[model samples]
Target: MRKHTGKSVSRRLVLKAAAVGGTALAMPAIVSRSVLASSGEINIMMWSDYLPDPFRDAFTKKTGIKINFTGIGSNDDILNKMKATNGQGFDLISPTLNRSLLWEPLGLIQPFDMKKIPIDKVNPAMAKMGETVWNFGGKGVAWVPHIWGTEGVSWRTDKFKPAGEFPSYGDIWDDANAGKTMGRGHSVMLGAGLALERKGEMAPGSMWAAYQSPEKMTEVWSKLTEYCIGKKKNLKLLWNDADTQKNGLLNEGVIVAQTWDGPPIALKTAGEPVMYRAPVEGAMAWVDGLALPVGVKNVDQVYAFIEACYDAALAGEAIKTHGYNSPVTGADKFAGDVYAKNFADAYPGDALAKLNPWPPEAPWYAEKRTEFVNKFMSA
Candidate 1:
């Protein structure tokens, strides 16, 4: 064997190295305290609103470790960056459920040290999702549950009313609601497809799932595509994120569109007559979390960061700031009257109980993204 000495290598080599290195499982080497101190920050790759000012400020005030927040792009962008970096010089990443499966298998991320961040501290439902999803189909550890929420239909009570007491997923395809409705670009179709399948109908996971198949995923996709195309005349907009969907319903009067719980909760709190319903067939729920990458330099600091996030007060701040329910135990107590009042006044009875579990691990989504996107999402 020849000694290897190169400052840079090809990207393909980086990926191959990660796979060969078991996703950079073991740390390369610990840098000296002086070297780490000279670098002066804990780098983070996460979603927007993940680490709000209060959480960031509280952490910095407690420890002098500055946060160099980067990677605010799409999930693919962040995962590709982590893959390219080969587990070096980053502390944490909070990828969605789908991305975790890919990263963990390649050993791009490290197994979460439960002792450093006790798994019991998180919400039980979220904890279960994390255990199954991040734990690599029961063998590997990759992503952890950072945030979780459901995708469902949201409607403006101020503008319209359907014929029935409760709205169903099939309401989107109804002609009576025509031109007053919207589905979330392709996510609407995918989520609806999931809802349909959970209720014994078939549609692909994404509109693109039509091209790739176990046949089931494509069956779901095709149904959703037909539903959307048929209802295209009824749509006002195809939404992407929570805020846009909320504003579209509130300001634009797009009465019914697929959305998560956060916006409807916020709008209702602000005295808007908005409602997020968990259709009889159930809704699609998602869970995300924090994990140390393979190359993270400061294990101690990374552990501290995880613990800080799990802290009840910090977790409460994250909940208030981000609007997702916290995974941290006892965060409800720290939630204060604002959270309590809003939460209590927000949903209908059994709303929390009605929200269902999202499928834990799905490898095919990332492995087949191009096919899924092309068939379903593309206009």
Candidate 2:
């Protein structure tokens, strides 16, 4: 057997290894952890608001494990940073529940020993991923839900009001909002597909079936991309992160957008006329959680961190900080009436059941989707 003499965990090398019979899975032995152990800090790549100073301080005070935190705005940021480093440096990542299954196959993440993490403390509804998508070959679960949220419509009530109880995703693409609307590129395409689905344009269940095969994915997404491109003239900006989403609505002359549940909700609480809700087409829901990276030096500290995150009180307190919901059971009780009211307002009626979950991505699906996303962005 020829040995991999180099120290780098670059994506090229890992994927190359995986192509030749899953040699990529043997990551624990390839990367040295002596360098990581000397630092003695748990390197975490997670959402910016997820690790507020108080949360970090409390966790550090309790476990004596300091966090070397790197904040990310999107899941793509998580993928990019990890790819740039070949999955090295960071001990933990928070891939979305739907995206978690792709990591182990790429040899980027290790699985969780379920017994070590407090999975039982998490809400059964949110924790189900640990038994399905996150589970790798029935051996170990790769990711666990920490915080969960939806992607839907947000609009400046004073600036614009569509004629509906719950505005449809179609409103964002309408000529009335042209040059005054915005959305994240690849994602809004998904929203547009849902809109098409509801309108009897795209086949029902086709969007979810995109994950089943390469042809199905391209067939579904290509139509969505075309529809989005036709409406491209209507967009004021394409936001990539939460800050950009808020800024576009508040300052960039954007009145309506398809957005994550967090930013617009926070703005509303702060007395902005902004409001976010489940669109008539349905909001896209997803879970973001901690996933261990391969070649972790501080495995014990990683497990400790996971255990601390399962604390319901702390998780609930984080709701106001990020404007997103917690997956920890009983978290809402600690979040107060305001959080309760906000959640109610966002999903008024059967919208919760109508949430279109982001399905797990197959590697080829990701590869081919990028081609369309780039085409739409440049178009």
Most lDDT-accurate candidate: 2
Candidate 2 wrong stretches, greater than 4 Å: 1-40
What's the distance in Å from true for residue 208, model 2? 2.7
Model 1 backbone overlap count: 19
Per-residue lDDT value at 5 in model 1: 18
Residue 132 CA displacement from its true place in model 2, Å = 2.8
Return the TM-score for each candidate structure: 0.73, 0.85
TM-score of 2: 0.85
Tens digits of per-residue lDDT for model 1 on 1-379?
1111110121122222222210111111332343233324688887654666667765665566788887452466577787787877678887766455566667777677675565676655456555665686565455556665556677888766645554666666567777777776545665556556655655323433443455756565556666555556776776655567677887776887777667676676567787766565555555567777878876677766666666666566566655556656666565545555555433335444444444333467545534654554454
Task: Give me the displacement of residue 200 in model 2, in angstroms.
Answer: 3.1
Tens-place lDDT digits, model 2, residues 1-379: 1111111112122122212210111111122233223335698988866776777776665556789998898888888877887888888888887776457567777778887777887766567666776677777777787787788999999998867879778777889889999998878887788788888998887777888988878778878888888889988899888889999989999998999999999898788999999899878877788888886778877877776677667766677567887776666666666676677778776676567777777678888888999999999
